[model samples]
Target: MRPRKPALRPGKPMVRRGVPVGSPFRLLLLGASFALTGYAGVRLLADDWFAVAVWFVGAALLHDLVLLPLYAVADRSVVRGLDATGHRDRALYVRVPAALSGLLLLVWFPLISGRVERRYRLGTGLSPDGFLARWLLITAVLFGAAALLLALRLRRATKQRPPATH
Candidate 1:
């Protein structure tokens, strides 16, 4: 079903008719989410909160100060390299898989690095020895799929072009 356009006030900007600009429902949902987060934080703080607070602050600072610059530099390098090769369109294919793999590595660093091997085994009754291999396999699959998709897009683009006149 199509949305109905609502009449706008003389000075007001245009918006979809059925949806109000600055939706009250979105505001309500945002307020609800904040309230729930605050409630959870309070409950969590009731027991040994200092460490949790420290962790939260430290993670934010580390990501901002360290990881962000590191990744930004890496992305710039990728872009520069692709541009030099005259294949900038292929950058997204590389970037998407790399970003996904990086995220997976970041989230599972402890298991992947075997730093928490004992704790992991105690918690899950399984070895973390295979994490590296699994991560590698996942990274390989992501890149392979991305390459396939890039090839398909290139093929489609070529096919959509009209023939050149002699």
Candidate 2:
């Protein structure tokens, strides 16, 4: 005897073999992403495949062995400090800016620190001098915006709350 298919509710997602498959639009998006990744992989491999493979392996090892633990510890410390200060709910304000800053630093490290000045200038014919300043400015802006948002949220909450009783 064949197994009966499960009946899906009007608003519920479709499930196949006990796994939620999500909407057809999501499946189409996933397929398109996979195809794009495969195309990029083919083009990359057509170049220096060995160097790319080695770099990928090295990046994976470095992230797993070093970066992962470092960030985990840093995040835990932040959470602990916020929790102790009774402002744990406001951790996102600190985390978002720090994460954006860290990402910018990571992506532009060589240029920002002037390590690749000669190579970058040779390739692009432009000096890689102002990246550090620009990155710092962007980091400042992200933090300032996050702080402003937090201040507004606090003000709104205060206004919404009733007056304290004696």
Candidate 3:
């Protein structure tokens, strides 16, 4: 007598466990954004915490409407430059600047405000000199810190990824 091996199915759907990587992240992100918008709308309707509500809206607009476009342009320009010239270290020219800009916005605004009171110039709602200097100093410090972090990260990454064949 011959023993039969386990019968194999010709077609079977592979069962996957846990949340699919991208769908859950996308859902979570969208859900959080919706919640934030809902809260903001509720605040606006109530009109009790109007100033804070307005500021939140302004921040969101600044990021989504203004900052995003600027970054997209900058990213395209940097990538074009890298591609055109065939630069060896592409990330240095792109990610470093972006990271520094992010850090500057995150840290500089708060830190620099403590050093000097924001003075409004006559007539104009916003002036370049005060805004530029504060941001410039912040960005410079941020750039230096970002560069250091980048070097460390690059070193770590290099250690982890095996060398590729030509």
Candidate 4:
């Protein structure tokens, strides 16, 4: 039997035209493209993609294998360290990434080299200093500028605030 089509009636609700793509087909196409891109990226990057991939994989492995415990231990250590009779800074965690990334960039200054030759490094994924270190350093410098601007605004706000009532 042939499929029946919806009838168009002028007075009743207007019949909708068929979509160029239905949700399922679009989703399948999207998933296939995603897979294709990943495959191409792996092929093009070959050994170098290994570093980023391995970093992510190592992060997962470490998180599963070691970091969870380490995190718990560190969290305990931090709670113990605040020796605060009661004073605690709520924004500390928010600032930690920006702060540590800056220190790391400084420490790994050599890795921040943007020389054209560094393009070769991407394919090999092997950086004497490591991709994370370099990317973090670059990101630190760029985003840290934004962080610094925030700090400056905070400083200015503090200076501008009215003195506490006596």
Candidate achieving the largest TM-score: 2
Model 4 C-alpha lDDT per residue in residues 27-98, reported as the tens digit of each score = 677889999988887786687877877886798998787856865666555555643533234235434654
* lDDT against the true structure, each candidate: 0.87, 0.88, 0.66, 0.61
Poorest stretch of ten by lDDT in candidate 2: 6-15
Clashes of 2: 0
Worst-scoring 10-residue span by lDDT in model 3? 6-15
Model 3 alpha-carbon drift over 4 Å, by segment:
1-50, 113-166
lDDT of 2 at 70: 88
**Each model's backbone clash number:** 2, 0, 0, 3
Model 3's alpha-carbon lDDT is 0.66
TM-score of each: 0.61, 0.65, 0.39, 0.30
Q: Could you tell me which 10 consecutive residues in candidate 1 have the lowest summed lDDT? A: 6-15
Candidate rank order under lDDT: 2, 1, 3, 4
lDDT of 1 by residue, 54-142 (tens): 88898999999999999999998999999999987788898999999999999999889899999889999997799999999999999
| Residue 27 alpha-carbon offset, candidate 2, angstroms | 27
Q: What are the runs in model 4 whose C-alpha is more than 4 Å off?
A: 1-65, 75-87, 93-133, 142-150
Score candidate 1 by lDDT. Answer: 0.87
